[model samples]
Target: MSERDADSDDPGDDAEELAWETTGTEIDYTCPGFDVRRDDVVLPNGTETGFHYVEEPQAVVILPLTPDGEVVLIEEWRQAVGRVNRGLPAGSAEPDDDDLDAVARRELAEETGYEAGSLRQLFTIEPANGLLNSVHHFYLARDCEPTAEQDLDFNESIRVSLAEYDDLLSDVLDGEIRDGRTVTGITRYELADRWQ
Candidate 1:
């Protein structure tokens, strides 16, 4: 069923039936960018258990398009993966950032030195809900142009490049682009017309 229909008064919908009740929550660990949260919950069957997840601030990912229709991409060193990963410009929202569009613009400028002439939100998604409490706000940035030098964070190592949209899509499909946000952003942009 469609998500909207399922959210309505659907006779067979069992959302509440399988829901778990959270009795309490605690922070198991704290870090600069994320925290480990543990929730004490009662399952549908009345079994008590603890669920752990990584809680983080919302993030923004930009699919930047130059006036020539090329996509701005970033190649960055990923310590977790032990290799450089290619992806769209993305960053977590800072505590002082109140506007998502501003965050998107900031990240794009910081990572790639590109500024968007026009920016529009495409969609939001939980890239990994089962293990992480995170929301990714996806944006489509058009007419992007390099206007400044990259102002990367202390720990960041990024290189910016432009690629044809078709080539980026091909990389995603051929399993060369494994970054989830980049893949999702590219696919969403491709399917945006049908969704609208």
Candidate 2:
């Protein structure tokens, strides 16, 4: 069943039979995002390996825009990419926060010293498909203004840039903006005519 459809089913006597308990042991394998353990368990008549996975917090990324077709972005050094990556402002989510849009606004100001006058939710993604449980929420900001203080992490070295709307697609395709989220946000916005 699809993730969205799983919760849509009506509860009945069949609900009790939805999940079956495995009667085998579990063994763990990795400790990347968090500690994980897997073990073999008895399932029906055969043995099944059950995995215990750990979780982390969710994250948010904001793509701020102007009514005049301008995209405000950041260019920062990334160790993995071995160079600078230009993209939207993004960061981890906070538990106390009710939604990702709030976090997106916070991160936008902190990273770029720019505050979105208005915020619109875009999309959410599971950045890693492996063991870790993390999400990246995307947002669209309008009429943003620079804040007095920039909330940058101690580990981050970021610069700021603004690209015109009509030219954004070409910029992303030309490799000027190389970050995945950044590229997606830019291309999607341009394609949707949101920049207009």
**Per-residue lDDT of 126-181 in model 1, one digit per residue for the tens?**
78878887889999999999997899999999999899989999999899999999
lDDT of 2 by residue, 1-196 (tens): 0012234345866764554454543335443233354434445445455645445557777877766658788889999879988777788765588866778878888898888889888766665545544566778898877763787888899998887765767878898767877777767666774745
- Top candidate (TM-score): 1
Minimum summed lDDT over a 10-residue window in model 2 is located at 1-10
Per-candidate local distance difference test:
0.88, 0.69
Steric collisions counted per model: 0, 14
Name the regions of candidate 2 deviating beyond 4 angstroms.
1-55, 192-196
